[model samples]
Structures are given as structure tokens and as C-alpha cells.
Target: MKTRLVTASVLLAALGVTAAPPPVSAASLPPVSASSPPAPAGEHGWVTSTLRHMSLEQKVGQLFATYVYGADATAPSAADRAANRAAFGVETPAEVIERYHLGGVCYFSWSHNLNDPGQIATLSNGLQRAALDDGSKGRVPLLISTDQEQGVVLRMPAPAAQFPGAMALGAARSAGAARTAARVTGRELAAVGIRQPYAPIADVNVDPANPVIGVRSFGADPALVAGLTAAQVLGFQDDAGVTAVAKHFPGHGDTGTDSHTNLPVIDHTREEWDRVDAPPFRRAIAAGVESIMTAHIVVPALDPSGDPATLSPRILTGVLRGELGFRGVVVTDALNMAAVRQRYGDERVPVLALKAGADQLLMPPDLRLARDAVLRAVADGELTERRVDESVRRILTMKYRQGLARAPFVDVDEAVRTVGAPAHLAAVTRVTDATLTAVRNDAGLLPLPRADRSVLVTGWDTAAFAPVATVAASFTARGARTTARPATLPSDQAIADTAAAAAAHDLTVVLVNKAWDTEVGDPRASQQRLVAALLATGRPVVVVAVRDPYDIAHLPGVDTYLATYSYTRAAMDTLVRALHGELSPRGRLPVTIPTADGTGVLHPYGHGLTW
Candidate 1:
């Protein structure tokens, strides 16, 4: 297939602009080389030398990492066809790989059958093999990376083990547990032949109204986030040798907007960054993280150019590399994201990103446009040949360090065995058990009536409270009448019903899931209203905040407020055990919750309870 080239002039015209463009100057163009070299014998040694040998077109190809989707290899959708025609003018992965010798690929789970682990392994392995086979220097193993941040951002489903979100881990506040989780997550990806995991989100969640990064972040405290990030990085890279990328740096946790849909402008200054956002990244880099993924948010304080961090030289080269001294590969968040593509024309982005010191231009919407632009820039002496080599050297160095320079091998069966193995499950249990804090227990309503009395259970996603049902079952077995209201209750109705239900039962257990709406505060108001109603019943009510501790202070009427810090199955099971007096709540609140509406004394980090 012939590649299509969309010039900046054409792009501007399409955008309804008729401004005269400046002449393309030689100093503004990428430099080209006349001679090509032979491949070296060492794994990535050949990669570095071959990178040096590349002409302008080949060098440009090295900068792009395009997005590929769908389960069937050949089924192209309308969007895919348009992307192929406009970007690289290629419809198939084989063609794109062969035409530009593209550097890497960022994929979605839609491309493979995730429900079947073996199939996922086969598909990803095949994609990697295909990239290596099409290389000019005889099989350059492409860096296969993905956004497997777990929880809400999880890429793999079913068979793949899903751990609690970063917020849950932060609430647990156990670096040891975070490390264990990372190792398990890394081993799982390594099994599927995925070399890099775009994870260990270093964003500190300060904005409760943050539409995107609420539960995805560790917490609001920068210190705790930095410590946990280092631990997670160590777990993934050191424990499993899987390349873990500390992402959305210099931090996406504080932003209220989602970069996937719109560009978010961070107003913090360099001093603010150094104090709040830069610590976790510095710690991660110091811990030897292999890669750093730049965010799309525009921080004017960091870069006066008014560009997203992904395309900002001040942020990528000046801040991350020069100031913070991160020597590893610097990868961009998906360039195709609306934050970039909707503003800067697709063709001009890759070249600018390369010049900005980005090693990888991830998920460019139009790979062909990016390829041709980089090639044209190189031909025109806009981007230097030395610059291309510099990035290629870094890439090669990382590969060599990862042992991918020697021999690349992935053990599929072993990966499946290690993903959610007994040890990993134990770690999850330990962390959840340690983190569940009883913020308020005025009447000592917990350790609910031993199987000798009647009890009732209720909440959101009521089915999730099955463990509570099991507890009730055990109580019934012990000659107690345990009735469970399986109905899904809106917060207020559930509370009211609990009160009415309490009239019949000796105790009422309200299972609460703190639902956060980005536009509103007090996600627990309904629960609070319900708890008030239930308290009027004169029944012992045990409240569990399944996600955040922010709701605990709002509803103190309940005898006990247990913060599970998450809604994962393991967490639920642990909560059930704790309620039945089978297990003690050993964990503490990793973050503080404000006492009064805006008092800011909820429960400071490191607040917990003993048996």
C-alpha cells in the first residue's frame, strides 16, 4: 500500500485557516545520513548500530508507536480504515510494521480474547514476533506496552487477576504489600510476552472531584504516594525484572479533567511541582524504574509554550531529564488522545515529540502521517540524525539491561500460576485486613450478635455482600435467624428500610459503597441520611465504607464505620470475616478525613484500630 502524506498546509486548510506559512528552513529540519551500517551480533547492539544506519525515513519510523485494535487480525472497521488511509496508508499490522519498521505498538484488550489466558498469550506473542520478523536489521523486538493500571483502568478481564485500585493500596499503606502486588502484576504481563507495563500511577489524589484519577491514585498525601510508588516499581522491576513505567508524570492525580477526552491545564508552579508532584517520580527513578510516561496535561508554569507535557520539551527534557535526572526511556501517553490530535495536526506531532526528547511517540492516531512527517523532517534536516541515535541508544540500553538483548523468553504456564497465586492472594488479604479502619464506633456495635440472635444485612451492589450472607448462614447454622435484604437500595431508602428491618431483627448491618460523583461533594449524604433513619430504629448498625474513608465522618450515627478502602471481592470477604469477630480489623486509615464539612481532620494517615 502506498503511504499518504498530509502536509501542515493541508491540515491547516482543513481546519479552516488560510494563514500564509513560513518557509521550511534547513535548521528546522531533521538531519539525514548517507550510509547504512550492518547489524551487530549482540541482541540490542545491532539495534543501536542499525538505528545509526537508518536514512531519514527509517529514523522517523523509529519514533512512532501506533495503536492497533480488534480481535481478528484482518477485520478493519470504518475508523480503522480511515486511520490506515490517513496515517500510514496501510490496513494491516504486517504492512505498517514492514513499511515504516515502526518502533513499538500500544495495544488494547479488544485485539485479543482476554477471557482465555492461553489465547491472549498466543495473540500477544504473535504480534511481538511479527514486529521482530519485519525488522530490517533482522528481528528488532518491538517494545509492547499497555495501560494495565488495574481497577477501573484494567485492560485484561476474567482469567487475568484484577487487584484493588491504587487508592486501595494507598489506604493499606504497606510498602511490603504494594511490592508483592507489583511482582504478581509484573509476572502476569511477562507471561504474555508484554515487556513494559504502564503502571505504578504516581499521581497523588488531591482533587476529590477529579473525573478521571480518583481511585486510580494512591492518595492525597505526596509522601505516602512517593513511598508506595517506589515500592510498586521495585516490585515490578526488581522482583520480576518486568519493565515498569511510572506514568502520567509529573502527576495526573490532581487534575479534575480527564486527559483522554480533553486537555487539562495544571496551574501549579515549579515550586509546587517540586513539593507535591515531583517526589514520587524522583523516588521511582531513583528506585531504577525503566521508563517514564508523560501526561497530556498542560502545565503553563512548567512550559510557557502552552503545550501538553507529552509534546513539551521543557517538561520532558528540561524537567524530567535535566532537573530530575531520569535517564531511562521517556514514553508519551497515546498521541492519538484528543488532548494532542484535536489540537496539533497528526503529521507534525511525532517530529516535535522526538525533538522534545521523547523516545517513544505512543499510539499516534495516524501512523502514516507521523511516519511521513518524521521522514520529511529528517530529509529536510529538521531533526538531527544524532538525536535519533540518542533515543535509539537509550532504547537499546534498556533492552540490554532487561536481558532482552541476550535471549527473550516467556513462560506462559508459569505466568498463569503466579498471577493470583496463593502468595499473592495472601498479600491482598493482609493489606486489606491491615487497612480496614474503624473510624467511629460510639456504641461498640461491632462483633455483631453471635449466631444466637436475628440479624439483617443490606447495601449497594447487595450481591457483593455475599460474604455477609455467608456469615448470616453460619449464624443460622448456630440457631440464629439471619435475614438478608437482597434488594438494591438507593442510599436513603436502604437506610429507611434498614430501620424498618431493625424493628424485626436485633441487629442491622449496612454495607455502604461510597459512590463518588466528580461534580458533587458528600457522596455519602444518602448513606448518612439512611444511617440517621436506621439509628432511629434503636438497632445496632455497622457501616462499612467500601471505597473511601471520606464518608465515615458524614454518617456517625451507625455504631461502627469500617473503612475497607476498596470494593474488591477479597476486601468484601475480609470485611465479612471481621464483622463476624472471626478476624480483627488490623489496618488503619492511610489518609486523613475532615471531621466537620470542611474541617480537614477526617482521619490522618496512619489511623487504625486493634482487636
Candidate 2:
């Protein structure tokens, strides 16, 4: 009966219709309401009184969320400070706060080395103190945010308890699991004095070649993405009391180009857009997502001029605000991306975004120029003061609801305990284990023949696998001899050597961490070559995808295949347990795995095998 239902669901998903519902009904999850407007007294009185006395410059500043960086808790060295200034065009968080009177700050892994939870807490507390002390007169708390989207885009280093991103949750196929993952993420971030989490990417990844939003999105199914995203918003806002922002609005899941590098145009017609791209956003709004981040893509059907959504009133005001009935704040994607920078320079992006109905200007190329541009526009009547106030009202109302007005400071010690807590780690382990989907097991290669077989392990990682080397160690503990051939798509000569070594092994396990393009290296062709070489050895091989499940579509005629969805330690443990027959492979494939030629989908969205 279960097999028949699973087959039926897979077929339905393959046809792009809603599949059979999971065991846990999405309707059981509580809906998150839109943030209530600020009250007249007490906690809300501060925001109302503060907004009445703000100058035009201050009001404009409230709309900008600047970038911040810290090498370590000891404060950046002179050289590091200079490097930061060169990179972000801002001196420091304190300096940016003082000069711009910015509304918020976003920390990045590259800029802020968030390796230690204690250090992150210290940095956040100090910055919050600086924000409180700055004579902005209003004493409004800074909305500290980071890209803690888990999975592929983990910002914090060690103690953040990163989960297996969106698709993993989709593969788990439980709205309750989605809520738990997000709740854990929000709870840890809230403990660190970071009240705003710019996450729960609501885009439904319909395109397999979507370079930017592959694993970041929930999956290819619109209804599935809708349910998971709504649950995510609740986890962050309703459960954790953190301001959750549902992002890349309208949808970024079907594009082939990366918005960070260039503008990607979505050419879907009105009916097609309604069918594929718009459902998740509607669901997110229904769940009362506090904010929606605008995409950097151009949709011609919506805006005939071909302007990016970030600068189009037709899309933002006419479509998102008017049609969707979303009263929450609309934040722009980073202005530093070429889509905005190449077209309208840093000086004009914020002004245009404001006119286009964006409430927040996030990570503008130049903070000073962006803020000044908005102020000048208001003065010259290009933008009205009422328009600025509308955004300010929404921003201040959100902050108050997020608990910034009442009690903003967090105890550093408490923050350390909250992030990466044992319970949180345990929850991550459970979810990843449930998400270990084995799509191909034609050769019955799993539950290995013996504990003492010689094995070869290689794919994407450093020698140790960092926090956990459990995959190799698991086999070793069972008395099996294991050898690692870890390489970053080595030269032709090096590939030959690795292949020769694999040929000597009794069994081979190849890991493929292919997803979005990495800045440091290009291992595309080399990894494919390495896999081909290993398969040529005529030895039984097990291919485990540690990053993207789509890696299987490229390897034809392979006997065994598995997907872990991410490289987290919990995911690794899940892999080891499944390989040893300790855990059953029950996770369904979330996204459709396209054929190597990108012409067709080999494994549809809901296909998975269980022993």
C-alpha cells in the first residue's frame, strides 16, 4: 500500500500537479499574522514619539541597512580596517551607524568571521551598545541581520547549528519539520542579539540549472514550497519572535543566470507566472511574512520597460503591494550586485527603490551616497516626505513587534549557550536522517557486503571533514580499511593516479558537492572526469551527493546513488547510518534531477527508494 502511494505521488509530482499530502498536514501549522502597527504608549510610545521628531536625513537613514565586518572580537587591526573600507566602502559598524544613522546592519561570513558563538555574541552586543549610545536621539535599536539560510549559505562558522537548507526540508516532506528547522535557526540568532533573520527563501526552484537558488529554495513544487515557506515564516516570527523576511519575491527559482553576477530575465506569461512563480509569495504573505525581499530580475510581462523588479513600481507597488495585498516591508536585494550597480550607480539605486515601494535599501554599494540620494530626492520633490514616512512607519512598527523597543540587549553568556545547543544539534540530526533519500540502488550496493572490505572515499572536502570525519571513521570502527582520495578536480595526471588507487580498493564511495559555482575553484569538468575514471575501474561504486542531488543526472549507468542534501556533520552521520543499514533511506527527492544534457528530468521531485 505504501509503495503504491509513493509511486502515485511521484507520478503526480512529475506532472507538476500537487502530490499526495505528507503524513503531517500543512494546515495543522499555525498561521503567522502580519505585524500589528505600533501602539500609542508604553513600548509603542517610543516609536511614535521618535518618528515625530526625526529629521528628513534621519528618516532616510532609517531606510538603509548597511554592511558590517569584524575579523575577530579584539577589534580589526589597522590593515584589516583599511581592507574593509576598500571592500564595502564603509569604515566600521560603529562608524556607519554614527555617520548614516542607519536603520540596520547585516553581517557576512567574508566580512564578519563568525567562527565562534561567543565572539559573535560579543560583536553583536558591542554593536548594539554603540547603536544605543549614538546620539541619533531616537534610541531605536539596530536591526542586526545575517544570511543564516543554513545549507549552502551558512554564515556562522562553528556553533550556529546549521540545518540542511530548504530542499532538505522539502525532501523531509513535513511542515512540522520545516517549522522546527526555522525555529531552531531563529532561536539561535535571537539569542545573539540579532533580531532580524533575512531567510526562509520562498522561491520554488523549478529550473534545475538555476545557479543561484538551487538548494536555497524549498523545491520545484509550488504547493510544497508554499507550505514549507509559510511554516518557516511562522517559526521565525511567531515561534521565535524574530523578524522573518521571505525573500526574492515573485520568484527567483526558475532563472538560469545568477543575479549576483548579472540580471536574469523571467519571460513567463501572466498565466504561467500565476501557476509557477506566484503561489509561494501568496502563501508567504498569507502567513504574514514580516518582509519580502525584492528580486533583481526583470519580468517583461509585469514591467514592459525591462527594469529590474527592485526599481519597478509596476512590479513592487502595482503587483506585490496592490495585487498580493502584502502590507509588510519590501526590502531590496543588495545594490552591490551588477544588476543594480551597472544600470543605476550607487547614488540612485536607493531613491529609485523607494519610488518603487521598497521599505528597506539593503547593502547599498555606497551607504553615504545612497542615503544622501534619498534625502535629495525628498527635498527636490522627486520623492515625497509622506512616501518616506510610510516606509519609516512600517520599519518602526516591525522593530517594535520584534521586541527591539522593550528589551534589546542580550546576555552574552546566554547567547553562547543558545546557539548550537545540544538539543538544537539533536533536532538537526533527526531531520537530516529523515532527509537521506536514495534514488538509485540498482546494484543493491548498500548495506555493504563486509565490515573488513577495503574502501576508497573521495569527493568534496578537506582531509578531516572538519567538525566530523564520521563517514570514513564509521567504516573503520566496523573493522573496514578505508582510504581517502580527496582532491579538487586534479590535473589529468593526478586524476589517473587517483583512479588507479581506487581500482585497487574493494569498494568505492565518491562524494559530489556540486551546486552553485564556488568563487575559489572550478571543479565541474574535473569531478565528472574523476567519476568516469572510477566507474571505468569495473569496481562496485557508491556515489553519495553531499551538496546537490542533481549530480546523479550527470552520472549515467551508475549502480548506487544517495543524497545527503548538505555537508553538515549531522548529514554525514545520516549517510553513515544509512550505508550501514542502521537507518532506512525514506527521504523523497525534493527537486527534479534533470538529465545531463538538461533536456529532461531523470528522477522526478518525489522519487526515492526505501529498503
Candidate 3:
């Protein structure tokens, strides 16, 4: 079957489906040593041959990586496909391939349950089969990519091991640990047929008020973030056979806004940008990263035009390509995002992004319009055919670099077994244990007495406390009684009730969960009030940040604080054990927790306590 696909592709190419135009004046294309040890470079020799055989429409199709939704890996049913088509403004996967000759597809857990390894592999294989069977010139394998960043923004469902996010890795203060995390993440993703992971966020999370970046970044330090980012790239590429995309280039770390909600402007001067935002990317490019995802941000210092980096030639081409010398494929962070969509509209976004130097259009709201718009731009000479070929070359080169042309299929059963394999699960457990930073332990109150002390656990909702119950059970295992209840925020009565309940307990443990770093001023006002009530009752109140560590800085009055960095099962369990003296808290703060007065990070980076 493989031979047939290759033979058909070669024969079709020989028939000159699209005659090769003069080679675009190669203005020093990124160098690749065909003799390099990696399999990607070994296949570099085939890029041009494959490109020559592709039709003009096929070339354009390769630029757009469309979004798809279905029950399994195969294309959705006629009815279901219609709905997805209507939503994304495209036809069935078959029509998408036959018409657009798509370059790739991005998977979201919303449509495809990426947590199920067998199911994900099945979906990936089915998509590849469609692409291979589409009867195109090269039978180019789809570049299957996903947002598997592992910490706070994990897209894969369980039993994919959830590691401590980037900040936790920073807390561990080990570049080797970051590399291992990325390697495991990439290996698991590759096992499930994901060839690329949009991860190792290169953002140097400098602002504590940053709503989106919070712990998703490694830490507040540029050099530290750079080392970890470089390590992640090596881990993903060398160890996992998956390409790693260092994201939000020029930095999304300092902004108090989320690009998903609106466009953010980074007002840093070029010199400051070099000092803070550009290091991780520079390290990534130097480490031979094959792809970079653009930030939906405007750097007025870099580009006078207010266009975000995703569509700005000055940022993407000038800084990323020219200044940093990144020769790899540049992909945009989902075009459907309001940062780009509300401003340019669907048709124009992809066209402008490509013109600005992006090689792949990720999840554009309208696939057909984006593709056709690019085709028209080429025809109307708004974009030269040479520019299109440059992108196609880069896209094709990445497929080769990923070795997709050589081995595009996977073993579904193997993927199922390997994705959340025991060793990988254990690796994350260790990371979780390592990242439990103890910010404040009033009066050496930690290693909470396992016997005779009454304990109460409360959270914003019962569901949020579901994992905390495991922590409570750890107390029960040690012969202590425990009770838990929900304290939904913004209701003064609920806060008062929660306070009343905590006052009766010998020790009160309150769980706080705020996943994204979106800055809505005083997000913890209710929690603060509840904690204040607990404090007023003269009982020892221990605050646990189950997700974002920065939550601690908001409640300075809380004397006992702990950060788990994630709410994964292992993390929750580790926190329980740490409280009982079974596991010592080792993780330091990855980012600063600014004082309530916003004077400084109450506990700066690398701050932690142990008993």
C-alpha cells in the first residue's frame, strides 16, 4: 500500500501536473547538512523533487493547516462533517485534501479527545490515509500538531501524565529537568501520532499580573528561560521525534491581557526586547528548533504598523528571520483568535500572515477563503509565486525533517500503551513532588500533626476540591478526621459560612485554583475574605495554590502558603503526603509573588521551604 502511494505520487509528478517555475532566487535559504546525523536532514535531499511535482493549487494547499472534528481519527460522518464544515467554513476532510491540498491539521481536545492515545492515533492515521490517498503529486504526510504544553495548558486528556508546568520546572531550577519534561511530553505525543507540539513557551513571564502566561512560562528570568527553552527543543527533536514549537515570539509574558481575548501591545523598546523577550527564541533557533509560533502582539518599537507579530512583516520577517536567523517553519498561534480575526477578517489574515513570513496558517476560521485568498494574491501578483514556494519549501522541509514522508503511520495499540506508560507517569509524579513549593510555613506549622488534629478543607467549588479530598484522605490514613466543603465566591453569606466552618476546625486548609493568569484585578477577593474570616477565628489556616503560584502574593495576610503548581492527581497526592511529612516540599517559586501592595514579589523566584 505504501509503495502504491509513492509510485502514484511519483508518476503523477513525472506527468508535470504543475511544471516547475524557475527556482526562486535563493537568498540564502537556511542551511541543512544532508549528512547530518538526524533523519530530518537525511531526507532533506527530497524536498525540491517533491516541490517540483506539486501543482500550483497543491502548493497553496500546503500552506493552510485546517482544523477538523470527528468522533474518531477518520473524517466525521456526512452530517457531523457538515456541522464542522459549517463551523470552520470548509467541506469534508476529503474535499479539504482534494481541493486545498492542505499542509497539516491542528487537533484540539474539544473535538478529538487527545487523551485517548488509541483514539488519537486512529484519528491521526485516518487523516494521513486521506492525505496519502488523495492522489496528490507527493502524497505529503500531514503535519499533525497539538497544544501539549503539559502544565496548566495541557490539551491531552488523562491518562496522559500531567507534569508540573513551565514555572514548576523553573522552580526545580534544573535545565536537565526541563529537557526531560519536554522529552517525555514529546515522546508521548509522538507515540499518539502527533509530530509537532506547540510547547516550551519561550515567553519570559516578567509580569505577575499577566493573565495568560502565569506559570506557563519557565520563570521571570531571561537566561534561565532561554536555557530551559533550548533544552526542551533538543528533548523534543532529538528524543521524541516530534518537532517543538517555541511560542508567543517576542514574548507574551509581560502582558496583563490574553491574546485570545484581544490584541496586546508590548511597549518595550528594541533594546529591552533584546534583553528580555528575545533570549529564549534566540536559544531555540541556535539549538536548531524546527518551528516557532508567533505571538498575537504588537511591538510598536519593532513595527510602526500596529499589526500583531502574527501578521507583521517587521516582527516575523525582520526580527525572527533576519535578526535571529531562524531558518525553520514559522506558524501562527490559531488565527481564529480575536487578536487577529476581529481586526483583519478570516480571508485577509492568512494572506497577510504568509506575506509576513509565516509558513503555516493554523486553524484559520475559514479554510477555503484563506486558501483561495492566497491563490488570488499570487495570481494578482500581490504575492509573488516565489514567496509561496519559499513557504511550501519550508513546510515541506519540516515534514521531511519530521521524517513523515518515510514513516507516517503508527501502531495504535503501541500508542495506547506508550502514551501514558508507567515510566512516563512516574516521571511526572517525581516532577509534581519536586515542584510543591512552600512559600510560608508559619511557626513551623508544616508536617501538620497526623493525629488528633481536626482538619477542614474548603475550595471555590466541590469539583475543585475533588482532588483535594485525596489530600484529606492522606490525613485520614494517618488517623486524623477531615471534612471538606465548597465556598463559591462573591457571596458574602457563603464566605461567612465558610469562615464559620473553618473556625471550628483545629487546622483549616483552603484550596485555591485559578488556571489562567488573566488579570482581573483582585481575582481572589472572595478567597481573601474567606481566609481573613478563617484567620479571625484564631485557627491555623493553610492556603494551598492548586494551580497558579502567584495567587499567594495576593493574600499576604495568609501566614501558611503552599504552591502545587498543578492540580493533577499526582500533584494533589504529593501535596497530601508533604503535609503529612511523608514527602518534603522541594520546589521553589518559579516566578515572583508580588506583595499585596505590589511593591515586589513577596516570594521571589527560587523561594521555597522544607522541613
Report every candidate's CA lDDT: 0.66, 0.77, 0.75
Q: What root-mean-square deviation over C-alphas does model 3 reach?
A: 11.8
TM-scores for candidates 1 onward, in order: 0.80, 0.91, 0.89
Per-residue lDDT of model 2, residues 435-472, tens digit only:
88998999877776555689887766744243124577
TM-score head-to-head 1 vs 3, winner: 3
**Per-candidate count of clashing residue pairs (backbone under 3 Å):** 18, 0, 4
Candidate 2, run of 10 with poorest lDDT: 1-10
* 10 residues in a row with least lDDT, candidate 1: 26-35
lDDT of 3 by residue, 253-326 (tens): 77766889898888778787887789889888888899999999989999989999999998899989998999
Q: Deviation in angstroms for 507 in model 2?
A: 1.3
Q: What does each candidate score in C-alpha RMSD?
A: 12.1, 5.6, 11.8
**True-vs-predicted CA distance for residue 275, candidate 1, Å:** 2.0
Ranking by TM-score: 2, 3, 1
